[model samples]
Target: MKHIFKNGIIGLACLFSFNAMAENYTIGTGSQSGTYYPLGGILAKIWSENIEDFDMRAEVTAASVENTIKVSSNKQLAGIAMGNVVLQAHEGIKPFPRKMDVSVLFALYPNVVQFIVPADSDIKSIKDLKGKRISLGAPGSGTRVSATNILASLGITDKDIDAQSLNYTATTNAISAGQIDAGVIVGSVGVGAITELAFTHKIRILSFTADELKKVSEDNASYQSIEVPAESYKNVSAFNAPAVWNILIVNKNMDTDLAYQMTKVAFENMSKINQVISVTKFTTLENMNKLNGIDLHPGSLKYLKEQM
Candidate 1:
């Protein structure tokens, strides 16, 4: 009986020790309805499963800008953000109060800047959006920054349009309800909000003209030219759009070993992650260099060197 009691106590102690050793981390993501949330969840799960005693959770945030802010402040261990947004933060550009200390883990995929309106609407081009009500995306979101910059590039300022700050879902809802003439969303090609909005309302994604694309890209080096396929959305034609890479970011001060382990595990399980999130198909070693000037975390750098 004494032996049995001693063994049971030993088992309990072991369990307690395991629990005590577990470390929890969080990755900031966008709205629950957006791509970042699910993608972040999948990544957190992957890292947690592969790294014993590690628990990573995805926290809902206002998307890129907020993610960068949180990650820099150490409110989040890491975050998913657009390349431009991270660049802005790193450089202490507008919206960011000061230079944020963050480093890139890797580039995930290109998030297209989409401008949507009803198919039959007279707003044929971005120029037509002048004097019209438009949603620039949620406050503090990278979508807003992209929209604002694009508009500024075209000489369309806040004075030129009635701007509304709404999130991905809200922007779609507002447009569907006729509350806004057009809405801007920066996300994966077939973002859930835009996809769901298409089922109930015939919509068109406005393509950027060559000159306009050049202007936007020139205005922001982080912006890239990408073509959205016709089949990406219902009844929407293939469109030329400005895109920015979506990157995984961490604080520069993150433990070197922890960052290395996380980066290594993520790359090793790319196939598994891609199976769950198609956009992650871009999360390859080759794409890691597409961080658009953001410094790579030392841990991730170490892992990448090993791959070479």
Candidate 2:
């Protein structure tokens, strides 16, 4: 009887040790009011439900810049970031505080630039934004960086515009209250904030001309020309929109098995996710192959190799 009790205690100890070693990873997502947050929530739910012995959760962050920082620090196992910003972060560019250990899991989708202005507002064009109060998205956000670059390409600098560094919610409120003339957001079409704003206010989306689009692509290698179909918003007409890509990144130090499982879940569910969100329609195996300049996590690469 004594020997049996001792063996039972030892078995319990081993089981507890194994359970303790099981990892629960968190994915750093964007603002609560944005698409990334919802998408990240969905991903976490799917992963936790489908992947064995691994738990996942979504953390609200200041978007791409903050996400990269968290991933680099190993506070997050994975994150969602704008593609261009990911490149910049890896290189320790102006916005990123330091070099990051960010690596790609996949290229998720394009984050099109949508500039919303009051219908009666005189800001009919990007060039007309001069001297007008505009929300350039939240501080330390990829949207803010993209807005800055676009304005600079058009010769509209901070000195030329009344820049309000506000988040999507704040910017939406400012525009509704007439506190600002325009608000710039980088999100997928059919964004919740933009949709809600359109229901009550008449807004216009200023589109980039072909020449301006050309110039933007030439200026930033990370940007790509994309089209935002008409009827994406109630108040906006369909137009050819130019925008940048948003990528999914993982911490370099993440456990290989965990990363492999995560990547496998993402690709395997891509088809189903696409059916739910049209933005995901663009996420294809070919596009994954097109992603450049970033190293794939070794586990992710192994999965990709098997697919090939």
Candidate 3:
């Protein structure tokens, strides 16, 4: 009995030691209804399962801008952010008060800027949105920044429209209820909020003309010209739109081995990730190099170099 008690005590001590050694970190993700949230949870699970003594949790945040700021300030170890916002943060541009030490882990997917308007509305083009009520996404979201930038390129500024800041769900809800004339959403193709709204309401997605695409590209290289494939949403035809890559970014201060392991595991488990979120199909090494402005993390760089 004495021997059994001693062994039991020893086992308890080992369990305590293992638990104490586990490192828990938070991956800042967008609102609960957004893609970033589930993706963050998938990633946290992947890292936790594969990495020894590592624990990660997904935190609901205000999306790109907030994630970039938080990750750079070391408030969170990592985050998913829009490539353009990351560039702005890196360069200390407006909306970002100072230069931040942020490095990309990888490009997760392209977030197409989707403009939604009621189907029966007279608004045929984004220009018609002038003097109309529109939601540009939540204040700290990358959608707002992208919408404002694209609109400005097309000569529609804040003064031209009644701009509202609402999250994906709220924006779609308001549109479905005919409260807003239009709204802008930035997310991977088949974003949930847009998908849900499409089912109940007849909507039209505004396409960017070649001239508008060229102008926006000239103004900001981060925006890419892409086509939304037909049937991506119910009754919505394929259309050309500008997109920005959503990337996993981390504080530059992250430990080399930890970052390396995270990148390696992420790439290796792309299949598993896709199972959780189909949009992760775009999360590939080829697309990883697409974000040119932000520097890659040294650990990620080392892993990528090994692949070469």
Candidate 4:
């Protein structure tokens, strides 16, 4: 079945995998200033350079959930998404209205949930969000989806706060302008936006309380406990949070040989990719193979098996 497409052309193939004669493609990545965009930019550059007949580029998007939607609709040949979101899309669960016919290309990185605030903001725990001004995330973005669920698990809701839906850049700017008390950003451990924010203003990354965390993990098994080390960004201290795996996804209809070659190229160009996607530096084929949110495309699985 075809899935939703956000401002892109949806391919005609929806019910089954099919090959296309054309080789041009676009990767739907996250915000221009976020981790996914840079990662996609590097990957697009690599694929364009290495694969003959490959005409590829990356576009800034709302990220994860939206990417999954677009890829499922064949609006994109491939995209990146959070593990939980891939599962949700494939299963036709909440945050998705219908099952998406999609497959995983490979697992990539993790996006940790970071609740940011000014250094002097009194809000410390998830509970403190009540009666506060907060920027959840852009209305349709993955950051908002995760942030909303995480807060709901701790008995907090939009009604409890002066909520505004804004993207990372706007949210961070709001915090700096003293317009919002806090903002929730799910990104790489040391996302560029956070790094830049810290360079000028004093900020704090909040940690969930034990009880809040217990509730969160119990409710959403997809979220794994993680600790962001001290000083990951300027003056941002160590803090605990939940993280979700990021996966590369593609339409199951992708040319099998093309998928295999693309998978191989990704591994071969890991070093260059690492410069833009720092989290990949810590991942490996072994750990990447351990991923379990969505079904792997047969083409991708075939390549992975050969490597094993």
Candidate 5:
């Protein structure tokens, strides 16, 4: 009887230790109503369900700039950010309040700059936006920053256009109602907001000329020239547009092993993740390796190396 009791106590102790070792991590995602939130939620669910000894969850925040601040302040273990913002945050540029101690886990997708005009609008090219009413996305959003920079590069100032700060939904609705002449959306291609807008309204996506692309690239090195194929949206023909990269980042001080496990679980269970959110379709192994400039956490490197 004494031996049995001792063995039972020892087993209980081991079980308690194992449970205590479980790591709980939170990912800082974007606005509750935006694509980043749902995508991050799905990723958290996948990691929590599939990864052993690690529990993951998502927290909604302002967006890219806010996520970077949260990650830098150690308030969040990880975050999803626009790649352009990630680059700026590391260098302590415009959007970031100050220099940040953030590192990259992986590149997620391309945040395409989509310019939408009402079907009846006379606006035909990027330059047509001059003196026109347009929604430059919401304040504190990466979309607004990209829009401002792109327009600035083309020598189009805020004074040249009637710019409104609004979210994707509001911008879409405004355009449909003719409250705005054009809307600038910086999100993944086939995003829910854009999809819904296309279904309800006849819209045209504006294309960037070579000269315009050159100015945008020269002004903001983070901007990439991307060809958003025709039929990607409703009532739209094919055209090339400029876009910025998006990345998943984490606090520089996060536990190396835990970060490694999280990164590993994300990539490993990506298929399951995509089933929950189509935006995650962009998450892939090849793009994960293309992340440059942003310092990758050592643990992330370890996991990627193992996969290789």
Candidate 6:
């Protein structure tokens, strides 16, 4: 970080004394098959190609909630997580033990709540899931938390269905083998897990009623209504569902100059990142830096202000 800030600023040398070695870093992303991993790969490649000596890599783990925890605990490591999970991490909500010192850089995309079943199945609506086996997403993931809340809003509880905590691939396999009735996935508009399922088995996406959507909105401010495009996947058509915003987050204690540099480099080459994952379309200069209830990193804030 020697050249991160121009010389002659007061206390600059003292500040650099502690933040001197800015070498290898990592971003805690989600599963390799999910968007976060690829998104991280794109950013890492861009930074290594465009910037100097910034050796970065993507670490696959649980998507939102785990990413938030890792970012809060480690200063050098950043994360890609859901907006609501980031908020929960910073505020020390139900899932978090205590308030975490975290901040956001830019917004990602939305995690569309998907309830998928075999195309020919008779499970018509959320109501039909009673006494059926369903995967609610792997434990400690944002999908699991969102799945539970979404079901609660729809008047479905744990007792109403046979709950299974499984990841996307596991859920997909179970549904394919007829071991489960349906699988709940929370990802972008055309998540790979559901799309992959369409290859071997006919898939049907369930739509949330307008009233159900309203109830979800009232219960969770982070989620929004969305429509999956028609024929986005094989043997599957369009459907409406609720979605949650995903964001790139970092520890507030991270080096401000490094954070600023990362933010600037990312926006300068947003197209490269977007090419790898189309969901980045939701991230924009107009509002990328804005988060729900958490603070934005001071360096990221500076970069956004200057871009204007």
Question: On residues 1-308, what C-alpha lDDT tens digit does candidate 3 reach at each position?
Answer: 01011213222122325436666689999988779999999999999999777779999999999999988777787899999999999999979999987889888899999999998989888779899999999999999999999999999999999999999999999999989999999998899998998899889899888998999999989998999887899988888999999999988766677778999999998899999999999888777767987778888988999987
Query: Which 10 successive residues of model 5 have the least lDDT summed?
Result: 1-10
Clashing pairs in 6: none
Give the TM-scores of the predictions, in the order they appear.
0.93, 0.90, 0.93, 0.91, 0.88, 0.91
Candidate 5: list runs displaced more than 4 Å: 1-25, 52-54
* 192-271: candidate 2 lDDT, tens digit per residue: 88998999988888877888888788878787887777778885877665677788887765556666787889788877
TM-score of 1: 0.93
* 1-308 per-residue lDDT for model 5 (tens digits): 01011213222112224436655667888665567888888878877786665567898776787788877776666788887788888889877767788888887888888899987789999989999999998887788888888888888999999999988888888998889999998888887788888899899989999888888888788778888778888878887788877888877765576568778888878888778777677777767845567767777888888877
lDDT of 1 by residue, 193-239 (tens): 99999988999999999999999989999998998889798777899
Candidate 3 at 154: error in angstroms? 1.2
lDDT values for all models: 0.87, 0.79, 0.87, 0.82, 0.79, 0.81
What lDDT is reached at residue 179 by model 4? 94
Report the lDDT tens digits of candidate 6 across residue range 218-261: 98888888988888888677788998888888877666887888
- Report how far residue 227 has shifted in candidate 6, in Å: 1.6
Estimate, for each residue in 165-268, the C-alpha lDDT of model 4 and write its tens digit: 88989989999999999998998898988889999999999997777777888988888888889999988889999988888988776667777888889889
Error of 1 at 273 (Å): 0.8
Off by over 4 Å in 4: 1-22
Give the Å shift of residue 281 in candidate 1.
Answer: 1.1
By the lDDT metric, which is better: model 4 or model 6? 4
Which of the predicted structures, 2 or 3, would earn the higher TM-score when compared with the native? 3
Q: Note the residue pairs that clash in candidate 2.
A: 230-238
lDDT score for candidate 5 against the true structure? 0.79
